[model samples]
Target: MNNIATTLFLGKGYRVKKQVRKGNELRVYIEYEGKQRCPRCGSENLVKNGKDTKWRKKLHMSFGFFRVYLLFKRQRYKCKDCGKAFSQVIPILRKKERFTSFFKQAVIFWLIFFPFDLLSLLLGVSRRTLLKIAEEFISRVMIEELKDKERLVIGMDAHRFHRKDFALLLVELLSSLPFGLIQDKKKAFMDFLLSLPPRVREKIDEVVMDMTVRYRRAVEEILPHAKVVCDPFHLISYMNHQLMEEKRVIEVVKKRKIPGRVLRLGKEK
Candidate 1:
């Protein structure tokens, strides 16, 4: 039971001290059985400080539809060599954190299928914690090397988050991956494009975007080799606007509002 628990969830160099099951919930009490040394100075000489009264409950993956949580209190210590205070470095966990690394991984995995609130309720985690975990994971992903840099079908669009605020998102259409985010402005977008390598810019096959005149002009000037295509939603919207404008002009001439491209039977009525 002990060995299985360690290998499965507690992680190596950590031991399961005690375990309990209540209804569908499983709680495993854990302790770090690894080396006791200062992280900064690597000294074995240390003084033990007090620990938290409440056990830190970190949610791991579900087992057979049963919620699993690893409960443990971090052991605080003061290093004699460097005079620095730190906690026992828990394996499968980052330094001094209340939650395990696996907990964050579980949050990220479930987030793909379920929305934040729903996942939070399912995992017994708070929505705020899920958001924090997502932010942490995304920041880590930003620094990693990108793959398939050449074969990219890119899409750029501005997302309005507030009444007056907007953000530009650059998504790889083929892979369905979002790679870049910047302020929604011409200069910000231009700066981002200019920052990319010329070789990469030249290799980009196409850029699909909404029919923004300035955006169209910028892409043409910067990536002249790459083909630019307007997305269908914006194209339809543009045609509808043109039809409305034409109808308004006709109404002024005849003094009546016509019913509504309002595309009828595969052709404009």
Candidate 2:
């Protein structure tokens, strides 16, 4: 029945041509009715050019005594307007990739229960492909995590890494996890902030930092909505700075260099 085919191959776009089973291995031959748009120019003017001579086999996971495989005859299309060749855009398949999107989901789901080697052997895919898939999955998950935050409290500060080398550290204060390390906090940090997804930027509730003029200016320009709260140590340090300056002025009024020690609190210190 088409219901079984639709469930196995992902949707109405596919029609079951044939189904073969030998022992525990199951092969489902199908045809795809996919989006006929040019991937290059987004034009719908396409013409059937040719079809692949061989069937492309994708390893879909196991289902109760049966290892499932999707066999598809890929069709090629030539864009009439762009004069370029393209393939049908399947929502469940990545362009020029062999496996379906469900296959990726299945692999990620089962990897928790299976060893990497066994999973790779069962899927008949190489170890390198598994690593690549895992990396892609982790990257997508991290991005989703970043985007899903309701409120993000950010902290940014410049620190001297070594003599004559300075760097900017940007982190989520709530999570204490650093997301960005920039060579310069000035323009680089602003650029990094700008590069963040607009949704993420909108969720920034506050930014904590020392009263670095450039840092403050960057925040004002990029994330003006976020509250800027100066760190406590910097606030005390600032008071000490002003006190030291007033002491220097008092010494100048006395018309002599002060011999007593002053509180060594300055930006350099």
Candidate 3:
């Protein structure tokens, strides 16, 4: 048995008197300790009241479900100022809640580590709920690392989006995090590049990109200090297949009974 799990349960309003595990099932016998003050006048003076009836509920664990045997030790407090006897509720656990604190922790961990559908299947929660938790975790921990940096080298590239062969991406090289997607029009890409700080813009040493003339023009227009270099692989591959492309287009136009010279010039153009 994990003592930390037992300690977490005790810290979360459950007094675990005994804990035993049989096979994969863990059984915990706990007593719910009521509040310390009098319920009527909120006085600290209290006397022992008789034990309430025992209650049984199921709690989820990592391995399987365990039956929690709860002995409600209700205390009747005699108010010194008002002279009234009343009961108080425990502060840690909410009223009528069946799942323990450890169980909640397990669910949160699962949501962070696994995908939404898998986490929903494991914890018996809806996928939407898991996605909400995942988004919360991302909001709490994941923030823009490129912002407020002394030097930021941003590289832009196009990635395949569905059937579209190219959707541009901006990468912050210092943090190795994706900054923004640059697609659609030239104006959008130019605007994104111009938004960086002047000092950070001056610190940019080099811009590595494929042999796209528009991308080169945009980088030169925005980042004046940066030297542009054509990424060799894209240039070489495009060059090697350029002739093959012209031949294939010419053959297609000839098969359609169009003039081959005009079609070849169009393919070359």
Query: CA lDDT of each candidate?
Result: 0.74, 0.75, 0.58
Best candidate, TM-score:
1
* Sequence-dependent TM-score of model 2: 0.49
Error of 1 at 131 (Å): 4.7
What local lDDT score does residue 198 receive in model 3, on the 0 to 100 scale? Answer: 61
**Model 3, runs deviating above 4 Å:** 1-144, 147-152, 243-269
In terms of lDDT, which candidate is strongest? 2
Q: What does candidate 3's lDDT look like per residue over 1-269, in tens digits?
A: 23643654556445666666676455666655545766566777766654456444545454323333333344445676777766556543444555544555566676447754565566665544443333333323332454467676666677643354345666666678655654535786787567654665677777878888887898888887888877778877786578557667766876644444554366543
* Steric overlap count per candidate: 0, 0, 0
**What C-alpha lDDT, on a 0 to 100 scale, does residue 232 get in candidate 1?**
94
Which lDDT value does model 2 have at 128? Answer: 54
lDDT of 2 by residue, 24-84 (tens): 8888887877668888888988999999899888766655455788888778899989898
lDDT by residue for model 1 (143-190), tens: 132344657678988865345666677877877777666668898778
Candidate 1 structure lDDT:
0.74
Q: Quote the lDDT for 180 in model 2.
A: 64
Query: What TM-score, over all chains together, does every model reach?
Result: 0.57, 0.49, 0.38
